[model samples]
Every structure is written in structure tokens, then in C-alpha cells.
Target: MALSTHVPDLAALELLLGVAQEGSLNSAARAAGVSQQAVSARIRAMEAQTGVTLVHRSPRGSRLTAEGVMIAEWAARLLEAAAEVDAGIAALRADRRARLRVSASLTIAEQLLPGWLASFRAAGRVGDAAPEIVLTAINTATVITHVTEGTADIGFTEGPQRPAGLHGRVVGHDRLAVVVAPDHPWAGRRPRNPWPVREGTILQGARAA
Candidate 1:
């Protein structure tokens, strides 16, 4: 896929996010361990690429424009996702003498894997050298497939039904609730005859909505 010319590079995006946090280019540069001039150059380059004046420079300091603030917010999210990808790659490349490869559903990988890994590390089960943890996030079917094929040591998924050839155990459960807009018909209705909500129905309704 072709990237837009307006999109700033990852390094420039990071600098923009830092400026948003520090509220000044010089301060942001200092915090990031980069020269002030380098920060300014990056910011200027980003502005040129984006075709927008991102910063308002003054004698006192620098401040982001309204658009700049919005862009910075988006940049922060992008940087966070990038960091996750970096960590996954590092884990794959780490010393593999003793490693635990895990395949997980997207929800579990995003919301639970970090905490679980941290707790496992704290328990010191792997002796002096910490066991390398490599994780990949995919759909539930793919998670099951990876485990069944012996490519992954373990798998985590959110689906209630387990596939064949796998011994399943429920570590936990998540409670789901129906949500609707205040004006929607279902907003205040407590159905006398409750029906099981299937994934296909919900997906169809969502597409229609």
C-alpha cells in the first residue's frame, strides 16, 4: 500500500508526541536526549510533509496548534502500537535457549498478555535467565491452529467453544453486556423472552446500523 505524503515518519511522530507532553520543543528535546536543533528540524520537516503549521514558536516557548494537538494525540496512539510491534519482534529475536512461544487472540494479547508475562517473570520460574516470551496475536481459529500444529507452546482465546483435539480449561470468563444508544428501542427494554445472541446476528445488525 502506498503511504500518504502528508504522513510523518515514526521518528518525527515520536518527537511530536514528546512536544505534546513537554509543551515545549527545547524541553521535549532535553527529555528525549536529543539536541534542541535536531528536535526543531524534525518538527519543521514534519510540518512540511504534513502541509500544516504544527507549532507556534515564541520568545517564551513553543505551543502546538489546535490541529497539531489532534495530530499529536493520533501520533501517540500510533507510537504505542509501534512499540508493541517492536517488543514482539525483540522477543522473537531474543536468546532462544529457553523460550515460551504463545499464540493468542487479539483481545487477550492486547489486554492480558503483558500483565500475565510480568507476573510469570516475577515468580522466577525460569531461574537466573528469564524465559523469553514470544507472542503472536491472531483470530481464535488461528490460535487453535497454531497450538494444534505445535508451533506455539500455549494459546489463549475468547471463544466459548473449544476446537477438537485440544484439552481446554477455562482460566477466566468475561461478562458481556448489551449496549445501545439512548434513543434506540432496546435502550430500556428488558425482554420477557430472552434469546441467545449469536455472533452472526450481532454482526449483521451492526453492519445494518
Candidate 2:
């Protein structure tokens, strides 16, 4: 992993933002609920990694340099992303005991599961009152396996393998497609080859049929 790609610990990023706004290392430390000396060490470590002088220290206060402005902006965004991640995990824990436990393939997991679950909750389909949904991602076969083993109350699959003991319900229709940039000559063709996508990439998802 590249060091630049390495997101610094959240505490340090918070401290940096505080220092930028407060204009004093001591004040930043107090705002962040850390020792003034600890704040000094954090600033030193951050500067060493990025090779930019983020703050100019004086007897009265500290001021951010030009590079510091850019770093502070990006750091603020990182902190926001971190908070979102935390909230997502918290929701998972809270909803784990939901009335409906659903397993689905990646396609349905990303595009359909959220909206379906929301509608299900609004309509209270699983039970009398609003029921929470516990959603999981798996391959087509895995979804069937989980359902059979009683791991999931319901499952959605795309491919054509119907294992014994469980009934397959055709809930919806889906079709895969291939397309390229508008400038490509094949843009006029109804059916294009999937060769446009390199490994680890999918050119298109289902279009509105």
C-alpha cells in the first residue's frame, strides 16, 4: 500500500483541522481533548510524511501555510467519510435482529436490495408493523445455499441452478448488456460484445427495459 494512499488515523486528522481553524497548537490540543505536547508530536509526524510545512509556530499562536490549506480541506472530507462508515456499521448492528433476513447476489445486493427493503419497511410486508431487513451479499449459488441451510429467511438468485427442497420464485426480470463510449463506432449496434470491459470492470448494468 502506498503511504500517500494511507489514510492517517482519524485522531490526527481531527487535530490538524482543529489547528488550522484555531490558529494555535495549544488551543487545538485543548479543543481536541489532547495534551499540547501530544499535539506537537502529531504535527511533526504529519509534516514528515507529506513533506509540507503545514503550520508556522510562534510564541502567541500558529498559522497555516499554503500547503496546509490544501491538506486541511482534504482532511475534512476524509473525516466525513469516516463518520459515514461508522454510521453504516452501527445501522448493521442495530438491524441485525430484524424480522427479515435476506441474502442476495451482488447485482441485486447493490441496485435493488436497498429500495426493496425500504419499500418493504414502509408497507410492513414481512410483519404487522414495520420490520427491519438484514441484507447480505453472495453469489447466485451461495444465496440458495444460505436459504437451504436456514441462514437466511429469503434469497434472490439470477443464474439457472435450482437446488432441491426450495421453491424458486421468479420475482423479476433482468438482462445484462454491453456498451462503449458514445464515440465508438459500435454505438449504433443493438448488441455489442462484452470485450469492451477489462478485468475487474463492468461496462454497464441493466438498462431500463
Candidate 3:
């Protein structure tokens, strides 16, 4: 539902509550970082807008009348609810930031990522709010696609070269070797490294382990 036109704005309500709490316009103005004139003007405006006398201002100081006290009490409740709404929105934003979306190849996701995530959680490098990891285990091609298409925040692949439109770094290394049976002649005979290929599994993210 739309807000009622009769209600004062938050700033005016806040000032009203401040006046009630401080028991003086000058003190409320000082607390609100405004001049006393401005505070008086705002209170007058609030009274005009609500058609209610909200303050009893004297030469010595200012005081809330009976109606003013009731209005101030209602304003206090409204301000508290506003504060709760603000805090809830802030927490939602924090939760969104504290999530890490990851796309990794099957090998890295299955063989290596679990240990890395465990260590990352235990290290407390990101302070108390450790990021929740949303991991997607897929083939190397799809991993690159996820990063390129912006479906994933980070990606890992077993490709030698970096994918286009994305920065890459080698987080971990592995070697590929030919496997043979014990009865096979190549198993017993020591041969020079047939294929000396440096396999780099790149993990693309804000930071890598």
C-alpha cells in the first residue's frame, strides 16, 4: 500500500523523537547536526503537515506536549521498524557478496577442489564471513563457456592456453604419463620422456590457492 500523506517524513519524525529525548530543541539540533532554527522549522512543518501541535517551546527550552509525546512514541516505533528493514537489506547484500560461484572441470572438482575449499574455510582469510562456494563440475569446454558467458564468477579448466576474454593463472600442475602393464616390455625398460608436456590446470577467479 502507498504511504499516507498525513505522516511526516523520517527526518522530521527523527527530529521529533530527538527533541523528546533531549528535552530541548538546541540539544536535538546539535545531535542532529542542524541549527536550532532548522529544528524549530522542521517541527513547525511537522505540526502543519499533521494538523497537530507537536511541541511546547518556551524561552528556557522546549518540551513535548501530551499529543507530542504520543506522536513521538509512534515515531519511535516507526523509526525502529525502518532500522530493522535497513539492517535486513544490508544483510541480504552481504550474503550475496559472500557467495562464490565456481565452474571447474570434472578432474579438479572431483580430485582437488574439496581440499582447497576446506583449507579456504579454515584459514579465515576472508574474516568471519567465509564465502559460500557454489561449485559446478563440468567438462573443460563448458567450464570455459560458463566463465565467458558470465554464468560463473570463476572457472577452472585443464586447457594449456587461456580462454579468450578471460584472465588465467596456473593454480596447480600435473604430469601425464603413459601407463603400461607389468608384463609389457615398456614398463621394465627405462625410456626417455616421450612426451614432455607441462600440464597446467588453470583456476580463474579473484584469487587462487
Task: Give a tens-digit lDDT track for model 3, residues 1-209.
Answer: 89878899998899999999998899999999999999999999999999999888777777898999999999999999999999999998777678878898888899888998899878765568568899999998898887777678788888578776677888867766788999988887866766655444564543332
The Cα local distance difference test for each model comes to 0.79, 0.73, 0.84
- After superposition, candidate 1 runs with Cα above 4 Å error: 95-209
| Per-residue lDDT over 1-209 for candidate 1, one digit per residue giving the tens place of the 0 to 100 score | 99988899898899899999998998899999999999999999988899999999889888999989999999999999999999987776554436877888887788777898898887766667568789898888788777777777778877557666676667665655678999998889886765553121000011110
- Clashing residue pair totals per candidate (backbone < 3 A): 0, 0, 0
TM-score of every candidate: 0.46, 0.47, 0.55
